[model samples]
Target chain A: MLSTLQDEKQDPRVKRTRSLILNAFMEILPEKGFQSVSVQDITEKAGINRATFYAHFPDKYALLDHSISQMFRQEIEKRMLDACHYSDENLKTLIVTVCEFVSNANSHCKPSSLQFESLVEAQVKNQLQGLLQVWLEQDDSDVDAKTAATAASWAIYGLVLQWSHDKNKKKPSAEKFADQVLPLIAVNLRLAQPA
Target chain B: MLSTLQDEKQDPRVKRTRSLILNAFMEILPEKGFQSVSVQDITEKAGINRATFYAHFPDKYALLDHSISQMFRQEIEKRMLDACHYSDENLKTLIVTVCEFVSNANSHCKPSSLQFESLVEAQVKNQLQGLLQVWLEQDDSDVDAKTAATAASWAIYGLVLQWSHDKNKKKPSAEKFADQVLPLIAVNLRLAQPA
Candidate 1:
């Protein structure tokens, strides 16, 4: 569904303008806080006029919401597909995938500002929830399967959040952590369906 | 450590002032992004002079940072202690504790913006890293325990983050999820070493 948003026939100018604004937004996040940047700043940075920017995005913050949603949805889709094959041994794969997505979702390597952080995170959270929902439905009725899937999705997202801004801690591979957690989840849930 | 900080209290007036400012900060986060709330807004809400506000916190953002740090530390401590009793069928008492913490930390009854979607997640991440560093001090030759710890901590943190935020997602009991993760963590990293 996320990938389906694109239309090859849409106005070329609209796509170009939107891409330019997103690039400008990403560049500015590392250098300045989101609240500090203005619509004028974005238009100027993107080499587009105020009207051109507005036509594509209502305001600078709108651009951020759009970019974050689209990018997160895309990344989650990809990760979920790749995650289809994950088992206990190579679990770090999923963590790495999610971490890269979160890290990249931030404007540059910076933490998302208070301005759009919640909205963006909400979208990301929804995407993860959607993915988990689908993963849970794959197997028949086991109440605990749904719980495990939910745990898997949130656990990965939370870990990425920690890794992004945590200063005092050393980093870990997300995949391995996921592997470690799955069995614990499985045991506690006592799933009727065999994995 | 957090308990220590809360105990060696300063003037009641100082405590009252800080509480006022932090409450005001949470009040405005939903309406205005964290990046937008100014010191003046806080002062006006707290019914304090700008000079008095500055006497406590350097600025609006600094107050947010401080508040977030304190909040993250507080939750980390609570979760660790609450989860310590990983009894029979308790399913990683740690995981359950964090889920319970998230579920309870912000509620409609109390409505804590300190636990707002974007704020303290980073603090949780960093705090987990610190915890892992302490927990993974075991003498393992195969993997660098620090990296392993970071990975393990992040994974658990991520799990809880998702669990906390998923309003609609079916969540397992804190005991169930923790039971799932804690043992796997112990096994994978050999965290079973005697502490």
Candidate 2:
């Protein structure tokens, strides 16, 4: 999936429209809750017609999902986690990425609407599962890569979600938190082999 | 959901058959990974007919889901985590319950098969969502209870999943692991309002 995305050849016009729509959505997302953001609003903000918006994303939720997925993918790619095989260090970086993503996502809106949270969850989990599968497939394990990926994806998302919610004045930074939970998460990845 | 379960009245024969089916499933799950455990196997183990098994559950997957849900619920109720509201201590107990549940579930099979992991995940995440919803409803906060509950539920399941996967010879016990993660999990519960 990462390779396909990296090498995709797209018409400049299509890319331009999609980018415009995403930028508009990101701008309005923090101002209006996800549930309140409308297709018309996005179209107006992006200086495009409603039809153009629909051509790119069927609805605002899809736009949100796509945007979040893209932003998160970039984060993963930035850390080079997307191109690497499973390693303790790579896994640690993955955790930090998720932690930062969740914290940043949460802080963007005044109070995160239900629609926003669920969309983010779906997008993040999907990508995490995909990336984990790539790493797992490179190894020979008795357990299925897809299932291991699913479990690990869920676990990584959960750990970051929990870390992002921390309100303690002394709550550890994402790096520290990721370091603390590293051992636990690395275990999920190794579940393909018996101990 | 808990209330519905507690107050339910059922035909004695119906209840008995369901119990028999569940018992048979529990006995067979470890022996035959979740994927290989057929309805025929469950019925033969339970001394019932295939039609009777179908009458209770759609298929082996449903049976696995139902049985795991019941067992995890029992685990929660046993810890009395089900009958409580949001509190740091209760959250700690919830984490402990999940850790124990994951560790014990992983230990049941030689290699935690893909089917086994997925089924356990579905059951655990569902119950965690329900339990977290109960806790969130008792609090007053800016965040939506259901959304908060959903995120928190996923995080808890993921964290425990990671903790259970740890292969370190000196890994912290479930209780100790829960203690370490309690603050992070507890913060998710208190997201609604400042306590």
Q: What is the TM-score of chain B in candidate 2?
A: 0.85
Task: Show where candidate 2 strays beyond 4 Å.
Answer: A1-13, A193-195, B1-195
Candidates in order, TM-scores: namely 0.59, 0.53
Candidate 1 B-chain TM-score: 0.62
Global lDDT of each candidate:
0.57, 0.73
Q: Which digits, one per residue and each the tens of the lDDT, describe model 1 over residues B15-85?
A: 77777777776676555655456788878887778789988876765676676677656665654542333
Q: Which stretches of candidate 1 lie over 4 Å from their true place?
A: A1-5, A8-20, A23-36, A47-62, A68-195, B1-20, B23-41, B51-65, B71-93, B108-115, B138-145, B165-195
Q: What C-alpha lDDT does candidate 1 achieve relative to the native structure?
A: 0.57
Model 2: residue B147 alpha-carbon error in angstroms: 19
Positional deviation of residue B83's Cα in model 1 after best superposition, in angstroms: 12
TM-score of 2: 0.53
Interface RMSD of each: 7.4, 9.4
Which numbered prediction scores highest in lDDT against the true structure? 2
